[model samples]
Target chain A: MSEFDLIRRSQEVICAPGARYRAQCVLGIGDDGAVLELPPERQVVVCTDTLVEGVHFPLDTGPAAVGHKALAVNLSDLAAMGAEPAWFFLALTLPAAAPAWLEPFAQGMARLASAASIWLAGGDVAAGPLNVCITALGLVDKGRALTRSGARPGDLVAISGRPGAAAHALALLQAGRVPDARELAALEFPQPRLELGLALRGLATACIDLSDGLLADLGHILEASGAGAELELGRLPCAESLAGLPEPERWRLQLAGGDDYELCFTLPAARAGELDALQRRCGLELTVIGRITAQAGLTLRAPDGSPYRAERAGFDHFGGYRGEGSPAAS
Target chain B: MSEFDLIRRSQEVICAPGARYRAQCVLGIGDDGAVLELPPERQVVVCTDTLVEGVHFPLDTGPAAVGHKALAVNLSDLAAMGAEPAWFFLALTLPAAAPAWLEPFAQGMARLASAASIWLAGGDVAAGPLNVCITALGLVDKGRALTRSGARPGDLVAISGRPGAAAHALALLQAGRVPDARELAALEFPQPRLELGLALRGLATACIDLSDGLLADLGHILEASGAGAELELGRLPCAESLAGLPEPERWRLQLAGGDDYELCFTLPAARAGELDALQRRCGLELTVIGRITAQAGLTLRAPDGSPYRAERAGFDHFGGYRGEGSPAAS
Candidate 1:
């Protein structure tokens, strides 16, 4: 198919007439560039993430999940910043222009985009390996947006939802075994926790989306904030489906395995009650997994207060520092 | 290398301390998302374009040129909309994290970003096939950005710079022949006509960036504006470097070529003299090679007013429509 045909059909599928930001887009797809209007006094937060076939997802993953995960991951970043996602541009490089594939892929993307009240602004579809790159744009109030560098030594490190279900599901998939429905759903359609992130705003000291598991991603907040953390591993909200795994494997999957789109944030002791309130409001577990410390390096403690360690830190796409029987190089 | 380390090195290289929109960026690379403050009265223009290895460029092309072209093409889209290029997010998927390749690549992208007064806000570096997708964000005053649908039947169609050099240069490179330095530069470092696009904002009726040659790109303007065009072949400004090619080949390169980062727009006859001033002000060709017609299809007229034709209209990345010795499956 011609690029123009792909664009026209794709545009038809993604045009959200009821999108929250529809009126803000002066001109959208079909133009060389999309024109969007920003409200006065708001800061625009932008994030770009890429999901490559076999690298970010399994080679045989469904097109719909691929599409869902593509936008989901980027929105996760915006959620990390307490940003309200309004629009996104998708660049899809596919082996061919298959309508059967694009239909479901775009539907998956549109479903998430509509749920988030965001519009698909514009992008390109080219011939190459199956790859999806999405650039998400969102808004946040001035001085209210969360960042990784805001954690204080006394801040309590908290995470939203069960953080490691996706990792366990991926492991199950790679092992050629059936995964728990919830775990598989977590792997394929991880929620962005947008409402929770919005709630965190001025409440959470710092925030980040967990893509590279809990330990490594939290390490970013620590490194940027010039602080460290100590996590109570027993307090970690691991999926119940992982109970059959060996102790170390469960710990690694929960702490060091990748592909969790949950939010890990830091909150002060004074704001702990506010988080509990937010937990009920957001309908997700808001667990205080640890505390930010003055010392460097991430430390973990078992339920009995013994030091705990993982075989590997986390998945690094380029370095390929992942556990055995795993292949998440995102 | 770890993704964090790559991001760190890349952040260091792309840290434009003196960028035009530096003050507008509340946060840049290293954050979950870059927070940018948009001017209230201006519209944000966004465009995303991707370049795949051995597709957009020769596999042997220098890392710097690849990096330069990666950002340049997206900026060209913003330029087409008469937007003031400001910030961009790059999602680069590479086979390896070799500093040897990255240094020059970052430097090359940095050079253009600095020249255009834009900043590398934030992005992702993943492990995959060599692919670069850039999402550029810029701004244009309200109600003033150019669009493809604004042309009138009587408008004068014009283009800036010689449009055939890049196509000819690629042909030469593919044939294992040395190309003219100027043509090579056109392919490797085609300058986006930002100033010309901005100048055309209030004057030109419609505008587009000429990437897929004159015929195909101009065809977009025609289709969008519900008008047609008649080109005077002899009036086209072909580079002197392409004069040695055969008659048909020369004409094909000039009219049906690709990768010319020039501005093509339609100006009303009343605005004709103003275009002359813009041509002088911009110090570019800005040649009027055709006239928009009330008819519905693009018509080609030879120097003697006879009908002219070419083997292919232009390169379509997915369709792979092109002439012999062409490999631009971009």
Candidate 2:
């Protein structure tokens, strides 16, 4: 198919009318640009991420997974910010216009978009090495959006859902091991905690998504908030698949693994009781694993009440210096 | 520098305060996402474009040029929509984080963002083949945005600025020939016609940016509007640099060359008079090149009124059918 034909086909698959998010988009898909109108007193939250073929996913990964992950990652960012996923713009680069690839890819994106009520707004397609760049736009009530700098001393640092499952699945795939269906799902179709994010808008002190491993990503919050954290290593939530692993291996996965797409947030002591209700209401796992401190560095605490040190921090694309006790090394 | 350091340096370079567009961005750079608020009664217009190093720019092309063009292309899409450029998100993928490259690229983007009053909102950087994808956000008065599907019979087709300069420059560069500084600048830093676009808001019936050559891009407007167009060959504006080229070469550049970043629009017969005043006020070259017709196919007319034909349409990455009389052959 021609570039135009492929775009038209992709549009047809992803831009069905009557989608809940369609109401926010004044104009979509076929225009020079997409038009969106947010209700008054709302702030728009925008985030963008690019997933390159080799660096982000395995070459053998299906296009559907690639498409789903591309949008999922951006939604993860919005979830971190306590925003509602509304619209996204995709910039897809392909070596060729392969219909075999485009169809499943669009289908995957359409499915996720429908579930999230997010509309594919506008995008560009070019001939190049395969890459998918997505810019997601969301909305939050004015001044209610979460940020990493909002954490305060004595706040409880918590996480939603199991973290590190995707990274563990990635390692399993890399090792040529056939992971279980749940592991494969975690790797290929990790869900962003959008509802939890919206619920935490007025409650969470600070929030971030686990994409670059828990310790490393949480360090961003610490740095931004000028606070410190002491994570209870024993309390870290591990995926069910990792339960059979050795203690060290489980620790590595829980602390250093990336691509989990789970929300890590901080709540004040006064609001800690709300976690149980939120978990029950949202049908999500909420675990309190740490506490914010006035000190200016991160610490890992073992169940024996001693500080634990790790060789490295979280994953750094440029291999920078890892923070002390960072779980970057596996 | 490490990825974090490089991002910090880039943020410093691109997010300097006091820039006009920075006010619209409530929070930027350091967060997981950027936050923006538009005034009441305005609609947000968004578009995205990606530039692969080898495909969109020469391997040796300077980082500054790549940065400028990456954002410029998205701006051109906003221009086509008759939207006022407001903010943009950048997703930069690099084989490595070389400060030498990142600094210049950030500088170039900063320069253009300053000129256009568009803020650099939020983005992600990762290790991969060099690519730059930009998503630009603009704003238009409610119900007044220009679109490709609005043209009608008897509307005068018009182009802003010279439409073939960048393509001509690309041809010269591909031939290993040194082009004039003017031609090189056209290719490296082609400006989006923002003023003309904003001015055309209610006046132009249809609008598109000439990124895929005049004939190819104009065909989009025709197809979207369900109308035809008859181009007056002599009236098509050609860059001064092309004056020395052979007739066929000039025609090919004018008709099929891509990356022009110029605006092509249609003015209804009654609103045609606005073009002359807009050109004079904006100090731009606005040329009436054709007329939208009730017929359903594009045609070309010679100065003497005879039909004209060409070997191909505009540049198609998938090389499909080209419209007749399109100067895609050089």
Candidate 3:
């Protein structure tokens, strides 16, 4: 199909309920650029992420999963900023136009977009090695958007949901073993935790998504906020899951594995009671596994009080540390 | 280099003025996402474009030129919408991180970004074949954004700058002939008519950029506006440049060339005189070559008033027609 036809057809199937722009979009799709009517007193948030084939996913992976992950990772970034996603632009480069792949990919992406209330405003299609680059735009109230530079010396470091499930699923798949339904879902259809983000607007001091490993992504927060962290391994969320693995493998997957798409944020000690209500509302575990410290280093303590260190580093596309973490996103 | 280091290093060189955000941008690089404070009463314009290595430009094209064109093309889209360029995100995919190519590429892009007063807000880098996709965001007065659907039957058709120089330069390169300095510049460093676009905010009815050949891009405006256009070839802006070419070659290059990044718009006949002052203000010649008609097809006429036809269609990435037009963008 021609590039124009593919765009039109993709829109037809995706925006299946006739065609109408979302409330905030002044114009979409057919224009040289989509126009958005910004809400009064709101700041716009933007994050871009790209996923390449054979690098992000296994060659045997389905197209729908790729599509879901492409938008999901970007949405995760917006979630970390305490923003509400409104629209996204996709720049797709494929070796060729195959309806078999494109159809399911569009459908999968449309599902997430509908759930998130985000519209596919505009994008471009080209012929090249398969690559999906998406730039998601969202909005937050002034002074409410979260960043990684707000952690104080006495803040609590918290994470949403079980962080190592996706990494574990990936490892199982590589070992030619089947993961449980929950693990598979975590790997394939990762949820963005957007509602939790919006709820954290006035509560969390600093935030970042767990795309890099727990320790690595947390390292970013410490570096930016000029603080350190102390973690209790027994306080991690998935104790039952870790019980089955060996000590070293358990620590690596729990502390150093990536692709969780969970939020790692800081809350001042005075407001730590705010989590009980948020946990019930968001329907996810809000685990406080660590505390921000004045000392300038990470300190890990085992259940028996022995110190420990995470061996494997997080995945880096250029650093060649493509370990058990995600082969996909940042 | 690590991905974080690369991002940090690139930002340092790109934002050399001690890393200050533009007035509109509240937060920039080194966050989960950048935050922008939209001006009151303004609509935001967004456009995304991608360039794949060996697909958008010749394999031998320099890295600096690729970087310039990657951002320039998206800026042209904003210009077509009569929006003021502001900030952009770049998603760059590469097989490897080589400073030799990346240094010049980043410098070339920085030069244009500086000249346009647009900043590198934020983006992601991944390991893959070379590809540069840029999503540019701009702003226009509420209800004043130019689109392709506002042309009236009696509106006069106009285009800015010379159209065929870029295509002619590419043709010369293909034929093992060297293009003159002007032609080379047109092909390498296209200046998006952003000022003229801003000036035409309330004047032009419909507008688009010449990236997919003049006929094809104009076809989009006509199709959307439900109007037609009748052209007088003798009135085309590049008469001097066409003097040395064969009659057929002259028609093809002038009417079917892409990558010129010039603006084409429809203005009411009464406002045609406004171009005289606008030309002086923007320092680019604005030529009126045709008028919108009630009829529904483009009509081409020779200088002697005989009918003519354009043969090759516009470039389509998947249409198997990689002809004289740009192998680059839509």
Candidate 4:
């Protein structure tokens, strides 16, 4: 589980299968930088995410979960843009030179990366307050990337999976309502739906990942698309914890809770059937809780047809809350 | 000057012309995660670097310099593999929101990225102990990456520019010795020799960037390439700081100091004429510092032919002269 061992394991798992990028890659995982093959016509995509100690995770979080989540969040962003996962670079910071921590962290990272089919490129390691940064790259069809600015006024707003589950999980963890194992599993790890994002390439008019809560994340789409939105709060998909909360509190959490990692997209009403078919094929629920509007701001409505106010904001790293920021906020 | 404004400015300056990654990049800056055009045949290169406050830089370091250096260090890794600069992502954590500090920092980053012809594609913003993580992407020729494993006994040891200036600068800074702007320039902003690396593609036997000082970095070459090196101390290039300080201390800093963004490379002696010509054509100075030896350890020789001892270690982020638990040491 030493740093070197983790690096070796990661190379074996993530770098072995991706032959698609072999032409431009001279040296990959074991080097200071992964070399790429830049052909005349091909372009590359780049993105980065940083997970910090007591910021992105609880102070007692495990290394393996940290590693997996680091890679997953980066991939989630790629998924939002309808990009296929291809390669990644990691910048890891550690509190100490703990081999045991590094081993499991690398193992978890490699497992998730391999599952997503991303090639392990290269990165730098530093000693610091526990921090993990991942930069990811993926390839897509030329000029066909789904962007947030492409949605039209009448586009039907959709989400790839249950929206408030991660937020609920966060709440449960903070409340100590779940035991160590369940709380750790929920808080430390959330799945990134890479496949659904790739499948959304042509179908999604605009796409975004739900990191901030449903309302806040949807706000990004609306702002980017230069349009407003109207969402039905009652239609929001919630997990059991969220479902059990009092209606006002539950609705509030669903509206502004964060860390969802789901894909929210917009498409024309004409594509409703197509989206429904995609949901059936993927066996994941598709929620149509909102629509792009010509108005200038976001509006929320309750299940009882009452207007819901934007009184809450999503999770903020700088905004103070006890126990690793507020689960209610997330 | 707010974080949002700083990001907007970076988007304007960093996203310049003649981008090679136009095809794979679906969305650039101003998004949660950038989308890429993952073509079937091309492989991508990804790398990351992190700079922590009070570890990588003084707390009061200029925002622009910190931003530039963070990205530059990562770019140096890409250069070692002869990768073509393509895209970049950044993750930043700050103690508190600072509008003035953010503006200059983004400006500095944008300046360096623009010079390197790289696009600042995407990044994340958060609050924490103040750290900057940068991930960079580059494209290389198919299967043509230069690695640390390609050197042999007969290879010629070479370097781009003089070394130890950065270490000298660090020493000076620590001692509160302020150099004129010219001398301070090298210390504040070190250049990664991207052009030299690309040009050495066919000439170098192996290559690496000199971040961890010469002797220690050379160790990586020896270990990875499985060959010993014989360095001629007389032939070693020394900068002004080396001549300015007491001889032993000066040489120690020069030989064992870190942060010189020069290129240390090996090439067959048969390519001597080509190497010389390449240097001349590029207006760069190429010096022969040593030769790869058949034996498996590094040996330094003075003008009188006596063996000189090399410092067994260089500046280590985790294990160096720095005190307990530096966040930069991962």
Candidate 5:
């Protein structure tokens, strides 16, 4: 598809209407900037993500995956705050203006956008080394935003959707240990759990999207909430693809793999029924992975009742900070 | 300064109450993302821009200049549409974690943010080749967005603020031809004409920020509006800093240089009185550079009333695609 064609296709997907913002956005997408109407309430949720060529993905990654991931990640952020996605802006740079690359990438982007009912809105495209920055706008009722600092002691820590699959897939890829088509697909195109996030609104006390390894990401919640938690390692909702791997490898992958795109949240224990009801309504699985504690740091317990300490490391955005078993640079 | 101190210092400058979106923002800097009260009005404006190392700026440039330029550039897009900037998000990638580099950068950014009366809502920092992507949000009246596609054949071509100083500065920097301090200041910091854009609400037939050089950027307005015009080249405004340069050299810098951050627009001649009135109130100069014609493309005329044909290449994102007179890389 040509750049225009890609835009046309994606526009079709992003044009869906559902939840509306109080400040009714008059014109979105297809312009220099997305236009919004400000009501008296005057509150909006805005988030942005930048995906670099090699740092965010492999150099030879396909355009479609690149496009989908770019928007999906931003939407995940909106979900974390119980906000409704409204509009988005894209700033795209490419080493060269390759129509072939632009077309499929936009097609993939449009497919995800249409499914999520997001509008392509307005953005800029220019020539440079490949980098894509997507800034998304979402809406929430005034004074109703969920924040990372709201978790209380005794809150139940629950997760929405499966975790550790993206990490495992990345490990498999890096290890040159080929998985079947299904596993490979998971690694290449991990989905963001937007629905799960929106459904967790009143059910979660503190919530965050797991873009980093579970241990590292949960650490953020703990740090922000000023509380600690104990997690049952075996309770993790690891992907079924790991069933083929050795138990130890699966455990490590579940603990240390990043890019899960799942929701890790905390809420009062009394909301167990509500959580169950919401999960049933949404047709998604919920895992009671841990519980908030008065203590001030995380602890993982193994199946045999010993403290699980497998020496897992968190994802490192800076080079030279390596996680355990990370493939050495050639 | 520590990362936290840098953030604090910058926040003091950028997210002040007078900044554009302060009233509606619930959470500004020092959070994962800026949260705002999404007013009942459902319309908004969003845009993004990325400044890369060695490409958009020199590696040795001051952090404050980098930060200010980054946010200012994005704000220019909002100004083009007569929108009030409300919130901003940043995504920054650095080659290393150097607090020394970050402090002044944050200070510069915050200062601009404060002066613009907009909030620094949220951002992400990681390690990589230096890159900064700033996504800005703005509020506009529903259906009141000024777009590039509204110019008519009889429209009068008008502009707010001087142009070409930025390009001239780049040339000077590259050739080690540093002008006096005043000229250097223009090159280092170019202001965005936000108030002028709002004042032009009822006057401009079409508008855009002169980012990619006047000729090329105005071409976008022409293409979008399906109209053409003849530019009186002699009528173009040049910075006083260019007065000392040779006339031809001055003309070259004025016509072909980019990064002026001024508004280039078309207004109907009927609004001459209103334009004059606005100039009186704002104390900003307004110039009639040309007139829109039924013709299909742009025309240039010399001061002697003859056709002016000279190199008018603008900046392109692609490396070496339109290198013009700058020293070519080996």
Candidate 6:
């Protein structure tokens, strides 16, 4: 298919019926731009992320999973900001116009877009190395968008769902070991915590999604808020598959391995009960893994009450750590 | 620099003051997402465009010009939509962490952003072949945005600024001939008609930007409006440099050349005087070039009333045209 044809087909796939974003979109696709009506009293939140082949995903990864993860990562960012997914603009570059790849990619992207109720507003497609860059826009009430700079000392630090399964799956895949179904699912189609994010909008003091593992992402919250964190290593919710690994290896995946896409947030200590109630209501695991600290650095406490030192914080694109033992690192 | 440090430096480079978007931004860089307050009665207009090395620009093109054109193309889309440029999100991919490239690229982007009053809201950077994808957002009053599908029979077609100068420049550069200063400026720094677009919001019946040459882009407006157009080839305003070329070459550049970030629109014949007034008021050149017709295909008339046939409509990324005689095609 031509670039234009692919765009038209992708639009059809992404803007399926029951799209909640339709009401807000005055115009979608085909125009020089898309027009969206901002609902009264709502603020716009915008974020962008790019996924590169061989960097963000394996070259052999399925197009559908690639598309899903591309949008999911941006959604996770919006979720971190306590914003509701509304609209997205995609810039897709590919080595060639392979219909086989484009069709499944569009389907995967559409499935998640439909689930999130975010419509594809506009996009550009070009011939180049495979890359997908998505800029997602969401809406939140005025002054209610959670920011990383709002964490405070003594606040309870929490995480929605478990972290590190994606990393474990990546590790296994790189080591030529096929992961179990659950691990494969985590690696391929990890869900963004949209509902949990919306639920925490007015309740959470600060928030971030674990794109770069728990420790690294939490470090962002701490640095932004001018605080520290004390993570209870024992309380970390690890994947069931990770339970078989040695303690140090398991902890490495939990603390430093990336692409978890789980929300790591802070809330006042008094709201711990409310959080529990929210967890039960939403039927999603919400675990208190740590607490914001007055100190200016991260500290990990073991079950034996001793400080734990990690080999590294997280994956850094330009750092010395190459993806030697990891699947794909971005 | 690490990704985080690069991000911080980029934020500093892109958020230089006098940014008109700052007022609407509830939060800018350093957050998971940028928060924006929608003006009370405005709708958001968004457009995305990606520029790939060698496809969008000459491989030796300066980083600054590449960055400027990346955002400029998206701004041109907003201008086509009669939207006021407000903010933009960037996804920059680089082969390496070269400060020499990043510094100038950011400066070029920020310079235009400051001039247009659009702020850099948020972005992502990754390692890959150099590519710059920009998603720009603008604001338009309710139902006032211009669209391509609003033309009518007898509407006078017009163009803002001369078309094809950029394409001519590219052709000359590809032939190893140095373009004049004017031609170079047209190629590297085509200014988007932001003011003209905002002014034409309520006046123009239909609009599109000449990114894919006049014929192809005008065809879009015609097809969208279920109409056609008859161009007076003699009426096309050719650049002085192009005027020296043979008639066929000159016409080819004017009719089939791409990369002219100029607005082409149709307006009611009775509104011609109003457009003239707008041209004078905005100090812009608005030339009447054609008229919309009920017929369903575009036709070109020579000054002697003979039919004018172009070799092709415009540049197509996946088409047979491979920028053979043009330095920058996209």
Which pairs in model 3 have colliding backbones? none
Which residue pairs come into collision in candidate 1? none
Top-scoring candidate (DockQ): 3
State the lDDT of candidate 5 residue by residue for B149-186, as single tens digits.
88998889888777777777777788877656766666
Q: For candidate 3 chain B, which ten residues in a row score worst on lDDT?
A: B321-330
> What does candidate 3's lDDT look like per residue over B1-330, in tens digits?
777777777776565342233866788988889999888999999999999987787777888898899999999999999998888898889888888888888888888888787878898989988999999998899999999999999999999987888888888888989888888778888898899889998899999999878888888898888888888888887646557998788878878778899999999999888999999999999999999988887887899999776776467788855344221123
Q: In model 6, how large is the Cα lDDT of residue B252?
A: 86
What is the Å distance of residue B71 in model 4 from its true position? Answer: 2.3
Give model 5's DockQ, 2 decimals: 0.41
Query: Worst 10-residue stretch by lDDT in candidate 5 chain A?
Result: A321-330
Interface RMSD of each: 1.0, 1.0, 0.8, 3.6, 3.7, 1.0
Assess every candidate by TM-score. Answer: 0.96, 0.96, 0.94, 0.89, 0.88, 0.96
Candidate 3 chain A has its poorest 10 consecutive residues by lDDT at A321-330
Residue lDDT tens for model 2, B1-330 = 777887788777876454566777888888889999788999999999889988889999998998889988989899999998888888888989888888899999888887887877787888888889989999988988999899999999999887778888888889999889999999999898898898898789899998888888888888888888888888977789998887667877888887889899998888777777999987898999989889877788878898877556787667643555533121
lDDT of 6 by residue, A211-295 (tens): 9877778888888898888888999887898988999999999988889898999999988999778998778899999998887
Candidate 1 lDDT by residue in tens digits, A1-330: 688888888878876667888888889888899999888888999999999998999998898899889999999999999999889999989888888999899888888888888899898988888889999999998888999999998899998877667888888889999887788889998889899889888788899999987877887888889887888988987678887777778888888876888899998888788876788899998889899888877788889999876667787888777443212112
Instruction: After superposing candidate 2 on the true structure, give the runs of residues whose Cα lies further than 4 Å from its correct spot.
Output: A16-18, A320-330, B16-18, B320-330
Predictions in order: lDDT? 0.86, 0.85, 0.85, 0.73, 0.72, 0.87
For model 1, how does the per-residue alpha-carbon lDDT over B237-279 read when each residue is reduced to its tens digit?
8698887777678889888787998999999987788877788
Give the per-residue lDDT digits (tens) of candidate 4, residues B67-149. 78998888888788787778877788887767677768877887888788887778877777888998777766566667888
TM-score of chain A of 4: 0.89
**Which one wins by lDDT: 1 or 4?**
1
TM-score between predicted and true chain B, model 6: 0.95
Point out the worst 10-residue segment of candidate 1 chain B by lDDT.
B321-330
Docking class of 6: medium
**For candidate 6, lDDT tens digit of each residue in B1-330?**
777778888889877588777888889877889999988888899999999998888889898899789989999999999998888888989888778888998898889988888888888888888889999999999999999999999999999888879999999889999999999889888899888888888789999999988888888888789898889999999788887888888988888887989999999999898976898987988999999989778888999999876777776666634222221111
DockQ list for all candidates? 0.79, 0.81, 0.82, 0.46, 0.41, 0.76
